[model samples]
Target chain A: MSGTAPEMGRRDGSFEREPARRVFASELRECRYQFKDGEDEKSPTFVLLPTGERSNRIFIVGTLTEKTRQGEQNIFYRGRVIDPTGTFFIMAGSYQPEAMQQLAKIETPAFVAVIGKPNLYQKPDGSYLASVRVEAITVVDKDTRDLWVLDTAAHTLDRVDALATSTSPDIVKAKEQYPSVDPAVYRKMAYDALAQIKM
Target chain B: MDYSEVTERISRKFSKSGKEIDRQKVEGKLRRLIDEFGVQPSEAERSVSNELAKEFNIPAAGSSGGTGAGAGGATEQKAIAQAQPGDWVTLEGKVVSLAAPASPAIAQSGIIADESGGIRFVVWAKSNALKMKEGAWYRIESAVVDEYKNIPNLKVHSGTTITEIEKTDPLIPEPSPIRDLRPGIGSVRAKVIQEWEVTHDRMLQSGLLGDETGTVKFVIWKEPGKEKLAVGTVYSVFYAQVDEYNERLSLNITTATIMQEEGDIVTATGGDVEIRGAIVHIAPGSGIIKRCPVPGCNRALSRQNYCPIHEIQPNFVYDLRIKGWLDDGEKTHNILLKRDVVEALTGINLDQAKEIAENNPLGMDEVFLQMRDKVLGRYVACKGREIENRLLVNTCERMHFESGEHAKLLNRAGGAP
Candidate 1:
């Protein structure tokens, strides 16, 4: 059954990680984590994963904390997880079958890494929501967290300088082609650029 | 946003550089550029960016958009013109007229005329009048261009290049003889034929004289230790100040100069006549007097009148009041008299008169009658300088009587003929 399980997972291939695409908490479109109640005796709480560059690429982070049942077949998990620089949303939908299964088995306070494309969700109140669709999952710790911040800062500055020097049309075109590019990335880039120059 | 927000944004943008840019300096430069070029804010911003980029090697942001190239071109031309300190310019013209010396530092303006133009050129007195031929061709060199009514004119200063060209033909048809004279200089001789004592402090004396041109009034000063000038005497006053006031030319004597009766200088043809009048109706309290009370008090005393301080009355007081006109004349002025002069004219001690007034109703009337004749129709020449429209004649030496030459000039000029 274990061999069949590995073969089935490989055949499905949805859980397979892409080697060329590097995932960091800073790069995640949305990140979230949930932990089980401290008094819970039987269930293991989910642990949070660090998201910035130097940290282990493992965490599912989001801003939403509540859980809701969708239809009768699927359960939705949502919460927020913050890296050193900022916070992002983590979400488990019906499409994230593995993440949903893991979420259901664990108690509250559980954490996991998430890999997915950034997506925008609109609420009925006319405000937009940001969350990451879960692709793969892992766990990380505090030492890894500190290095993520510094590495993220360096990478962000390079982007900022590039933006500042490029021709006006190029900037406009870059923004249009990469519609999902996080504006907060630019802000963080500017701040990091300023910090480096100050030093 | 509020001013603080805008300032914060600007500060953030400029703060990376180690040196701090004074916000006021930047604002002042902006305002000056606005005024100098008469440009709008956007245009001014672009110009400032360009100038800073070129001069300071600083990067300028957003310089592509502004008033188009033509308007900018014109503004640049004007700025270049203003920036240049010296430029060659020619003003070909005739010398039409000459103005009197403006001041010690400024050259007089000479009105010039030419086939193409007419303008005023400042000519510095370099070689006296020898270099400048009034009727001949005058070519000024290296004159600085200045603006008058938005039109360019030439100004000659100390460093100005100057040259005089020989004339093929005289440009000025009739040129008057040049004289080495100024407003405050030299001696003027005149004959004094009549005199009247105008006031106790000062006297007004006038006389006639005939030079190459004609005769005019020679108003002379009367001071202590100076010989009293007699009527029909010719006097040469050294270093007198000339002033044209109220359409009349008059001479003023300085304290350092001397006035003497020039007996040898005689008048040939008495020129025009001059007339002078005395001020009447002085304000009642506009003179000097001794206050009856102490310095700090407003009270007046009756018996043994004295200020409590030192148990003695101080001898000086100053107040302002108007006195009525005694002489009926075609024109009248408000006369000002000191209390001492009033007492002297009336021969009534003010303290005794105040006591008598308190005791008898007719005492004040008797004093008024005694002072009327002496105060009325008397010509009092005030010597003190004027304050606004009112003349404050402080010294008694300024009052003077009209001389016979003054009277004759007045009568001949159709006054009380």
Candidate 2:
């Protein structure tokens, strides 16, 4: 069998699936993508979205890529964390003081789990970057990594299917028609419905 | 759903597809497709699926292979050059010289040459002995690029690492020095030969002399030197500094430098003539003045005949002060009166003018009018230091009366002095 067979079995859940687990490496390389969280506070946050998110509240597992300096007193850390998909950066702020403290103690490649929003940061020089601010982190092993890859792959494929069918204006029209639909909910429903369509 | 199952599924799907797709490209395409389709997936569901597909490079069921390939290619082509911080690069160039070493510690950075091109670089006092063996090639690494005179140059900072390379090719030829060395240490020197004192405190004196490099301005000091040296006299200057100001380089002899009449006359060699055109603007208080209460105090008296300081009678003095235009047909300059020169030329005590102005409102106007003819359009030989646009001539001696015949003669001689 080709190396691609295992990837197919996991996508279809041909193998056993378990709760997502975190995988840590000596140096998890990742991009730092910035976003704002909370409506009022709108804190600048970074999210390390696992290369794939196929399950609800998908567990994003990686080690804190950046080191938090205890003496520096500043909240910015520069490091990369990795998962099965790819590597991404973790820029933790004061809101994530607990994560920061935990990160300071752990050595590079320590395992972690993050639950936060994902965002893209566009620079003036016309570059798009990806990053995450971890809401939580937990250690896990290879068994967990396998499960995450399967779940994330399924959801990602579903989104791609949804996008191929709908026109750009149809999405805009839906938003206008469903005035009461919360934007986040409407986006999810639209994508899921599109994903369900038969190719 | 377990993350391992998700990765396995993703891995299995891509493994079977026989085509590789980057997770990021898949995520972007999925997001755009969802937006285009008006399909709303729950945040959790959408995020989870997108993450899995993006991480595992799983193509959505409906995604056309052609479209995916095109998008992936476009994304890959857009990748920018990424460099980690603290990386170092090298810059090399030829040297461009400007001012000479006035003070031994002066560090001037000029041009350097490389096969690519020439760029400006500075060598410090510590690096002053960097053996710039004109034309030899040297390479400096980790030097950051900076702008000087709106031109980019390599700047060597503390973090900068430098390496010098020996000349493999022939030595680089040096450009000719801009000015000749005269009155420098161990060189023949001369003093002011003839001078014309202008109403303004400046004076211009010129004479014949010769050194290895030939005759040049020697003792052009402020307010004209106390005693002018006679012609045919040579002086020896122990130490003199050369400086470039306003693109003209000249020598400056300090008091510590030796100056004495040697009685030996040296013939002059014709050199490049230096000429400057200045604009003089006269304001309200610029004419012949009455010395107020003391020699230094320039305050005028009030109508009540009371001086600001003394409030009583004091001696008055007069001097030549100008309040008119000096036009050289090319530029117009407003000239002001130097108080001492005003006193010397007018023979009226400055203090007396203050006293008269105290009683008469038109007194200053009358005095300024009398000096206007002596100043306007008249040519004066000037030797001075320049600060910005204003020339502070140490001596301003009026050379020629303004007349058509004189103007004709000057024009005929190409305005030579």
DockQ of each: 0.00, 0.00
lDDT by residue (B149-215, candidate 2, tens digit) is 3344454433233456665663232211223541112233554443323112232232323453444
DockQ of candidate model 2: 0.00
| Residue ranges of candidate 2 with Cα displaced over 4 Å | A1-199, B1-179, B182-188, B192-233, B255-261, B266-285, B290-318, B328-355, B363-366, B373-417
Per-residue alpha-carbon lDDT of model 2 for A1-199, expressed as tens digits? 1113223333543332112222222111222322333456734343332221111112354444556543356654545666544566665566776445545555666655454334457769877565455433444443333333333333333333443455554334433443343323323332332232222
Strongest candidate by TM-score: 2
Candidate 1, superposed: residue stretches over 4 Å from native: A1-199, B1-187, B191-241, B252-261, B264-282, B286-330, B333-417
Residue A45 alpha-carbon offset, candidate 2, angstroms: 62
TM-score of each: 0.22, 0.25
**Per-residue lDDT value at B73 in model 1:** 17
lDDT of 1 by residue, A130-188 (tens): 55555433332322222233323333444444554655543555454455555455445
The share of true interface contacts that also appear in candidate 1 amounts to 0.00
User: Which model scores highest in lDDT?
Assistant: 2
Cα misplacement distance, residue B24 of candidate 2 (Å): 30
